[model samples]
Target: MIDNTSLAVVAPEILLLVMACVIALVDLGVKSRLRNLTYGLTLASLAAVAFLTGSEAATGETAYGFGRMVVSDSMGNWLKCFSTIAMMVCLVYGRPYAGDRDMLRGGELFTLAMLSLLGIFVMIGGHNFLVIYLGLELLTLCSYALVALRRDHTQATEAAMKYFVLGAMASGFLLYGLSMIYGATGSLDIATVFKVIAGGQVKHTVLVFGLVFIVAGLAFKLGAAPFHMWIPDVYQGAPTAVTIMLGTAPELAAFAIAIRLLVEGMLPLAIDWQQMLVVLAVSSLFVGNLAAIAQTNLKRMLAYSTIGQMGFVMLGLLSGVVNGDPVFARNAYSSAMFYIVTYVLTTLASFGVILLLAREGFESEEIADLAGLNQRSPLYAGVMAVTLFSLAGIPPLVGFYAKLAVLQALVVSGSPFYIGLAVFAVVMSLVAAFYYIRVVKVMYFDAPITATTVAAPAEVRVVLTINGALILLLGILPGGLMTLCAQAIVRMLSS
Candidate 1:
């Protein structure tokens, strides 16, 4: 029998699942005129689930059960809440475009989004290897179907195939790692492996092998360097709304997984993976920023930027310069969590504008398409400006403050290597800024391309307004959010 702990821990996911089923059934009994009804219910359900997560945070409840296969802690609470909000924003961003295109209102897209979010909760709460794999596969399969939802489009079909095949390969790497670790310590829970390693119960060779594959798999999810080849193609080809979900929500889920596996599972052997993380961080920073400069496609550019942002999170992890320790493991987990929140808001605002530009034959993925945007619509120009600046880590923007906090944490740890890495980060910031500034220049300086006009519904405009203001507000006055991050991470580590 399942325990009360597991039941309470998984309440939010269960609520979402019930809502998904109800929406599908509601589609049948309801009139075609009530298609908007499904959309409304879907968003409302997610908002309700987020409220539950908030309650969990407020009460500081952490539950573990099913042999520790599922966990509901500070980490999962934050991840589920953030991902649900991101999903809602994706809907807000996409509804107008999807309606304008006469896309199917089968209620499938929103349903699938909630299902995928269910998978994310599983991934965040997973404490066992098989549970993690199952969650990932569930989430990935939904994503593949969602990407191909616009099936009449050849580009959408091609992107789905690419995502499926590559995603399978990444899963293979994760399974291989799980197998190796099981061989080494005869355990599956992440916490168990940490115990086994600390107890010296595993052979050195097997442990090292397991560690390598695990990092490789996690890096792919995080979209860190050497494993990021799929991101740009997927982003460019998928629908703008789906792209927003992929670019924002999945990164936060990956961030949560890494915290559980590394901080809870592998800290006993921190020295072994610390340098490995550094290499990944540096590679992602340099490659992501530099490649983005040449991309004309806005989705692709943001995809690269996502890679760099993950690298910054990796820097916090590798430095061991967290809330507590340097030479020993610490709780930099909060820094990673906080950074993901800022990135989510920044990307939603960024992509919300991209969605607003989508017309009958054009989606605003290309940077050149934004030329003369200020003349076309000053509201769009202003929103894009704030979004772009925040992403480039410009000051007073939440993005800049997020980056500053991470770098400051690392620098204060007082390690020469981390200090030098912080310098490299500064240089890459310049590289990233060059691309961000280009969007501003095109919007302000150039004329709209070819007398083109973009039509967005009022709903999309409202989403754009909220997204824009939040980015600026978080950027300028980040004290409250930063405090939350600190508090959350402390709860996770000290629990």
Candidate 2:
């Protein structure tokens, strides 16, 4: 029977579910070109969910519900809160772009986005392997629909097919790995699996075999190297609005599940998994940076850049355990958390500029499309430049501090090997800077293709400005967020 505590633990999720259904029905009657009613309802629901999750996170509470199949904890709640806000921002930036392209004729975009967010919430809260898998499927299915929303666009349909095929394979790999763990441990619950593995009765070889598949599946989801084949194609082919939806908030969910499966469930095998992460990280950095440098399409370049960024996130994850000691686990995971948060923040602004410049019947996707952007509108050009600089790890930017935090985590581990990894990451950052700065140079140095000033709605201008400001503000005062992440991770581990 569901008790008050269990119901309270899932209050936000329940509200989201009811509101998503209501919005879908309400959208059926939304005849406005912008679907103003649906959009407003969706934003209101997201804001309410964010508040609930933020309050729960602030309390630093951990509660289990649904027969311990799900957990409500500070780390999960905070991630959920951030994901909700990211979705809200994504919708705000995407609506205008979608409307211009006639992609907002119906309210499906708003409805699908909300469902996708609900799936993210479930994934973050899942404490059982089956529950997590279910959430993963839900999110992926909705994402596939969202990508294919523009029925007449061949590129959109093709991207959806590719995303669907690859996403299914990854889900299978994850499920098969989870089944293997269950076979070895006789339990599907994460806590029970942890106890079982820590007890050392399971066959090491069997567990390791399953781990290989699990990491591959996770690598695919995180857009890490060797498994990031679909990212660039999808990002380039899908509508810009869909791309933003796919890229931003889903990342936080991916990170949370990684923490759940690898850190919470299979941490006793740290030596084994950390070695795998090192290979993934190194390859992602090497391929992501070098490949990004060769790309002429702005979206594809950013896709490769994402792969490299995930490399740093992996560095933080792999550095958590040193010589079988988890003394640095909190610091390491928290750094990864902080890195992803800031990365998402910067990404919103970067893509917001791209979406803003893209007008009807024209896709502003190529690097040359941004020529003399500074001349067209200094405000947007400045925002884009700040975003690129932050991504390149320049000083006095949030990305720099994020990189610094992860590097500091590695160096503090006091391992020669980790220190070497830190050095390698720095070199990769330098390689990445070249491409990023090249974009800025194009914006400032190249002649304007058209002298018309870029125009955006007041809402977009306000949101983009606030987003860019946060990137700089957080860089200057990252301590609060850093401390929040550290506290959340500590609470998670202790519970």
Report clashes for each candidate as comma-separated counts: 2, 0
Regions of model 2 farther than 4 Å from truth: none
Best model per TM-score: 2
Highest lDDT: give the candidate number.
2
lDDT of each: 0.83, 0.94
Score candidate 2 by TM-score against the native: 0.99
- Candidate 2: C-alpha RMSD to true structure equals 0.7
Candidate RMSDs in order: 2.0, 0.7
TM-score of every model versus the real structure:
0.96, 0.99
Model 1: how far is 26 from its true place, Å? Answer: 1.5
What TM-score does candidate 1 reach?
Answer: 0.96
Candidate 2 per-residue C-alpha lDDT over 1-495 given as tens digits, one digit per residue, 9 for 90 to 100: 788888887898899989999998998888988888898889999999999999999999899998899899999999999999999999999898899889888888988898899899999999999999888888999999999999999999999999999999999898898989999999999999999999999999999999998999899999998999989999999999999888898999999999999999999999999999999999999999999999999999999999999999999999999999999999999999999999999888888889999988888999999999998899999999999999999989999999999999999999999999999999999999999999999999999887777888898999999999999999999999999999999998888
lDDT, residue 387, model 1? 90
lDDT, model 1: 0.83
